[model samples]
Target chain A: MTTEKINNISVTTLANVYFDGKCISYGITYADGSKKSVGVILPASLTFSTGAPEIMECVGGACDYKLPGSDNWVRSEAGEKFSIPGNAKFDIRVAQGFAAYHYICHFG
Target chain B: MTTEKINNISVTTLANVYFDGKCISYGITYADGSKKSVGVILPASLTFSTGAPEIMECVGGACDYKLPGSDNWVRSEAGEKFSIPGNAKFDIRVAQGFAAYHYICHFG
Candidate 1:
């Protein structure tokens, strides 16, 4: 099942807007000091480079993601997840007319 | 001083996208059951109708807003706040080249 909500966290009041609003996210800090982000990607093909390894868990909608060194685009739907290594670059695309891709990013 | 973060809360994983992505927000629930939202408004002019009386507190960037029945647009910068009445409509605008307007929306 998809994780609908995250509990007992502190949220940064400001949003992190990237690619001129094509992607938006909020940083969240859990009670144990672990960090994550809840974000959405609008209809666009975008490349992202990671600082730390991340597990992207889909909560709503969907996207096709291509991991580093992969030629195939894998679909990640609600309740699905994909992992990306630190210092790696990957591509994600949400097609036009579809809903925005909503996800929770777990960082290492 | 600006309120940089909110503590002891839960966050909705999905986002509320408005005006075709010009405005985006994530819902937040406090430990005591109060609710708020962290959001950003990109460079655009938009109108919003309120269900509950709202306090829009700026945490970063800025916007010019016109309340219902007002002819003048007031500037709300970081650390500033403005209130809107329930059942009323208001207008907010961010300049084309300026940074996105980041805020915490508190509801009554």
Candidate 2:
């Protein structure tokens, strides 16, 4: 099921704007100090590198993602998730007229 | 002082995209069921109509706003705020090449 909301957490008021505002995210912290980010990627093809391992959980909309070392592009829709290893890079894209991809990024 | 973060709240995972993605916001709910939103407005001039009264609190960046019936534009920066009455309209603009306006919207 889609995680429509995250309850009882702290949210950073400022946003992280990437790719000239094509992607925006707000940092969130849980009671136990675990960090996550809720973000949206507009219709654009973008490459990203990760420092920590990341689990991208789709909360709304969808995107096609290309994982490291894989030529295959996979679709992740609402309620679905995909993982990326630490110190790796990946590609994510939304079609020009498609809706933005809204996701929760869990970091470890 | 600026509110860098809001603790012990619930955040909606899906984002609200406005002006063709020029503005994006995330809804947040407090324990008492109070609703607020954290948002960023890219460098654009936009007119907005309000249903409920709204207080725009700057968390980062800045904007020049013109309230209803006002011919003058007023600048509001981080740590500043502006209020608009219900059933009213207002104009806000961030200059081109300037940073996006980041704010918390309190509605009543």
Candidate 3:
């Protein structure tokens, strides 16, 4: 398929909420203002194809990440830098499990 | 919400696919076998509430993670370890942007 790299970065602020009666929250948002909020649930393994390149930040715990089409599974800690190819498809296999929060923004 | 710490760690493997003509893939999976695959599209920023405790591994780029109920915004590197409170809710704001992949597993 024909592909072109898109690099348009923008900034977005987040609001913090609680999880239990104690307090906690997690969610995802798209450039179009749509969002997906996730609660404390053990998630199954998942993967996806990239439509745009994204920068993810680790907040609470840690997670393992992998680039599709390669055996290189990169381990991300509480603070790390990583990149996903635009319009590319990849799979992630949670080897350790994660409680980390992320913010996914796009660059046009 | 009523909450309890759930640490049921299990192993899950991921398959790599392509993004462009090159081959890429990305997706998420729940313990019940439900999966959400993300393609090359800039995602909206999101957050969630924790139903279970999880460990996440970072594979590719860099991301910013924040814990719920706190002002602490932790920056995760390529290889680090962190933890999230069970049943807690948190939000992720992509500071730099990411192309990294992640694996999320659970421990019961």
Candidate 4:
């Protein structure tokens, strides 16, 4: 897709809410038909398992994430990106001062 | 609505894309049955008319807005909120150094 199409893609209403609303995100389809996501995570520690390899980008606020097999959680601020392997689960936490942690998850 | 419900509310798929894709947003519903919105605005100036009074909150990045009948544009930084009356139109402009503006619009 061109640059213009990516900025104005439609926001898909379909979503999944997990852990009693702790982990929430919405579905989005690019012009070429690949599906992705963008959502906000509240200040809480949660674990998520993804079926596909994902590129998780931190676009807003602050978050700490531990990829699978890692013992220590690393800080992620706005504008940072991380790659998580497919079929793997990771842990996320948000500390004080951030209203909500916003992110974009890219899937193939 | 309770605090937990608000953060994890599902991101709705249904949306309206206007201005040849200049303004894009998603639909959200509070637990109290009121409709709201959350989306990103690209770096461009656009005009919008609202059908209901909207509380425009700046969650990410910066923007300048001019309410109905106003000649000056006021700057809105992150964590700032503005109220736009129903049936009024406003102008929004985003300038340098910000990627995309993220916002939450509340309607009663």
**Full-model lDDT for every candidate:** 0.96, 0.97, 0.37, 0.67
lDDT over C-alpha atoms for residue A95 of model 1:
99
Cα distance off (Å), candidate 3, residue A44: 25
lDDT of 2 at B27: 98
lDDT of 2 by residue, A1-108 (tens): 999999999999999999999999999999999999999999999999999999999998999999999999999999999999999999999999999999999998
* Candidate 2: TM-score, chain B only: 0.98
For model 2, the DockQ equals 0.96
Angstrom error of the Cα, residue A4, model 3: value is 33
Query: TM-score, chain A, per candidate?
Result: 0.99, 0.99, 0.50, 0.86
The superposed Cα distance between candidate 3 and the true structure at residue A80, in angstroms, equals 40
Instruction: Give the alpha carbon lDDT tens digit for every residue of B7-70 in model 3.
Output: 1211111212222101122334445654332211111244655666644433323356678778
**Model 3 CAPRI quality:** incorrect
How well does candidate 1 score on lDDT at residue A107? 96
Error of 1 at B106 (Å): 0.9
* Full ranking by DockQ: 2, 1, 4, 3
- Give me the displacement of residue B13 in model 4, in angstroms: 14
Candidate 4 structure quality by residue, lDDT tens digits, B16-100: 3445334556665544556667655656898989898888877666689999988999998667888999999999988754555
Highest DockQ model number = 2
Give the DockQ (2 decimals) of all models. Answer: 0.95, 0.96, 0.03, 0.04
Q: Write the per-residue lDDT of candidate 1 for residues B1-108, one digit (tens) a residue.
A: 998999999999999999999999999998888999999999999999999999999999999999999999999999999999999999999999999999999999
**RMSD each, Å:** 0.6, 0.6, 19.7, 13.5
